[model samples]
Target: MKVLRNLIAIGLVFLVILSSGCSIKSTNENVPSSSNLTVKMLDVGQGDAFLIKTSQQVILLDTGDIDARDLLVNKLKAEGITKIDKLIITHPHADHLGGAMGVLMNFDVKSVYDNGQITTTSTYRKYIKKVTDSKIPYKQLLAGEHLEFGDGIKFIVYSPTKRMIDTEEDLNNNSIVGKLKYGDFSILFTGDSESAIEKELLNKYKDELKSTILKSPHHGSKTSSNNAYLKAISPECVLISVGAGNDYKHPHETTLNKYKKLNFKIYRTDFDGTVTITSDGHGYNVLKEKVQ
Candidate 1:
């Protein structure tokens, strides 16, 4: 009888140990990942461009207008970047993809990502040739796909789903909308998506739309950043890339007022030059170029 009791006690102890091990594993899986991601909104005058740097990777989003190539190259050189891990052309608009060819020619690119929409412009063809010559892997990101670059740094492509891609709508509507998450911080990047797309996103991912930082769509044009969409994002800071005296009058007064009403600190590339957001897993800081 004593031997039987001892055996039963040993089995109970083993079960307890196994349960404890599973609990620890589950806790580890739930812990948030850490990554140091720096997003730089390069001042390309009347165009849009951004650089994303994580601990192990560097990604360039768009390349701004054609003439901004030199400036973009200089910025990358200053940052000690000789290679680009990924290059994401949000759309085929000249203002967004014009200088991308220059980047492909100058840097070692691991992969290229775009919406895959074709355009007849010479600049677009030149970029395509560069991609072909480089022979780097290319992918057209779809909604719900997640990309992780070590250390828990993750990016979720939230727009331009396959259904939308097949319909052949406006290129702007096909813009790639991505959300970057590092630890507890989140930022949303909207590539010139207009009201229609914004409404779609708002309805689809209302809760997930919350972000700490927002890159104002369409350079803060009135056509984008609808009031309801802004409310849904509820960003603490808004970044706008626009030229000082551009023909389109970007960063329009009304849009500026909207952000002001929402109590969002506004950062403009036209006035502040390069805008950098640095985060260390918990919080982020925005650094702007010296205003002269």
Candidate 2:
């Protein structure tokens, strides 16, 4: 009887050890991997530039103002980036595409996407000349178009529809409005887009316009972020890219108050310098580099 009892006790101990080992192995397997999506809102001062990095590709959105050419190039180099897999110029405005020439000269750009809007400014002409000379594949960003950068990471264009009317209002309205989606995470980029376009997008996309983050339209200008538009696409976080002491008084007080009233978390390049948000397709973390 005693020998039988000892055998039973030993078996129970072995079972417990095996169960623990299995539990540990399962826990190790369940651990999450590192974040694969990183979006950096560069501080180009009164201009716009964003660097998006996925597991397999790098994308650049806009290219700061002319004065920021060297800084923008150096910033790209510091990240050890020698090539841009996809470059999207949201509009033809100087603050948005002024550094296009500098970027083309420095990096090997695989493809370029633009809203197909034309401007007669010197900077716009120079940009076109450089793009033509580079022989890079260029395409117009159209509504309903989809671009996939990696597994489960994609961009959906939602503005500048086929029937766009080329009027003065079309310049800002034609600004490429798109959303980057990865799993449950989504970010909306509205390049200088304002009320007219915002209203149209709200009508077209409705609930589909929801996002986790919003790059505030027109640098948080009062002309954008209308009350009706804000409520339609309620983003958890808002990023404003503007320069300190800018002439336009970007991120107007009323705009800030509206976001504040909505209880949305806001980060600004003017205040935070460079703002970066990284996500693992599930959730994201925001980090800022303070300007000295």
Candidate 3:
């Protein structure tokens, strides 16, 4: 009888191991195939945060605000991001760079890129310290510089061709503008750039500014999306990052109407929560967070 009991116990152990193996296999099947590219626009409330994923690398655009630090870290973990190949801080505004210190402290970042703009804010100071302490390679992104993350994926800087010395203009005008091209699809990321900068970009890049998607400048501020810039880029879709009931009333009504008249599809963080766009180089699909 004792021998029979031992045999039954061994059979139970073997079954448990097989069940666990099946569970792990099922989980792995749900992850997207490595051949795809993903861009996630996080909803960080009044701030900006973006994650770009290629088969072999990960890139982070702004880090949102300090208040969203925990959320940002959790999101990265959820996406299985163990390391950041490149981190780009578009400008020095708190909303754009505040959470950067947390990200730098928590992840292994290989490199960082910025527009060389500075601000006296405490958040900005700490962010700089974090980057320096990590001993990561840092570069002042320049216009015409190309970033190659993997085969067929290219990111090109298009603004801040030269340092701005004017003390009168708002810092928003100094924001870095970049474009990402993956085969036939392209996206333009205009930091918090205003009208004056937009006019300059339109004058310089002209048709080169065209993209399939545009992260709307200045969170859809009326002063940023002038007709000339819109016509120059002629994006098929526009994304605006803003907080619900924000004090600035972001994504101004007039600006939203302008996009509507242009017949471009518009997505907003405030309304959509988080937006994820997946691309296969030639085509893409947009996914919105489901309301709870």
Candidate 4:
């Protein structure tokens, strides 16, 4: 009788271990998978545009200057992107949304994301008209909405809150701020947002402002990239989009000095041509195209 009892106890222990192993395997299967999200900061002179390619989607943040349309099209073609999953205008600034009309005409876009806030530029008006004619789905993204691309890639809109939108400030202060996350990596894209906007976002999302990369706000203009904001973001690398010999003297010396003091690696499109960052869902690589 004793031998029989011991055999039953051993069998029960074995069953419990087997069930625990199965539970662990099931948990692993439910975890989200890693994704390869590639971000390309195209050199379109003194303008801003960023192409984000994920495992399941392709997104264009802005389109640079109107004249840069051809360059943008060629680059998209080279990437074999015949369609764009989403196009975010960020704002109605001429330099940011000017080439968007060309892109809308060239590609089959699933949707267009913008604040729908008008600006004084004719280019902005024309782009808005094109979107209206296309009848494509349009949505005004606001802060707190989290956008998810395939795999584990996600973007959180963190700026242009209701109060900021109502404030009669310069459009730059109202520019949309987007934070992208792919696994352990995060990137903050500030679209021409000035010191005031930056301060607001910093205060709102102080804990989440930590990012691995930063798209230097307003092309690294002195008016943006405030010291407090910079200290909060603490990006490991900074990318500045500006044109060589720009009349405005973009990427101001003061801003450059701030970045230098922080010891963050910097990549300037005007000097490096095109900058590309690719991630394996764990680590990222920064590649620069030599300016010809």
Give me candidate 4's TM-score against the actual structure: 0.86
Task: Compose the digit string of candidate 1's lDDT tens values, residues 27-54.
Answer: 0112224337888899888888899998
Positional deviation of 128 in candidate 4, in angstroms?
1.6
Residue runs of model 2 more than 4 Å from their true location after superposition: 1-33, 165-169
Task: Please list the residue runs of candidate 4 whose C-alpha ends up more than 4 Å from where it truly belongs after superposition.
Answer: 1-35
lDDT of 4 by residue, 1-292 (tens): 9999999999999999986654211101112343388898998898998999987999999899888888888888888989999999888887888789889989999899886576667887787778888898888888888788887888899988766666655778778898999877889999999988887888889889999899999999999998889999998899999989898899999999999999888899887888888776667777777633
Give stretches of model 3 more than 4 Å off: 1-35, 165-169
Candidate 3 C-alpha lDDT tens digits along 1-292: 9999999999999999987654221111123333367888888888889999988889999999888888888888888888999999988888889888878978999999988776788888888877888789999887879898786798998877665723434667778788988977788999899998888888889989989899999899888899878988898889888989988889899999999999888888898778888777776777767332
CA-lDDT, candidates in order: 0.85, 0.87, 0.83, 0.84
**Arranged by lDDT, best first:** 2, 1, 4, 3
Candidate 1: Cα lDDT at 86: 88
* Cα error, candidate 3, residue 30 (Å): 22
Worst 10 residues of 4 by lDDT: 23-32
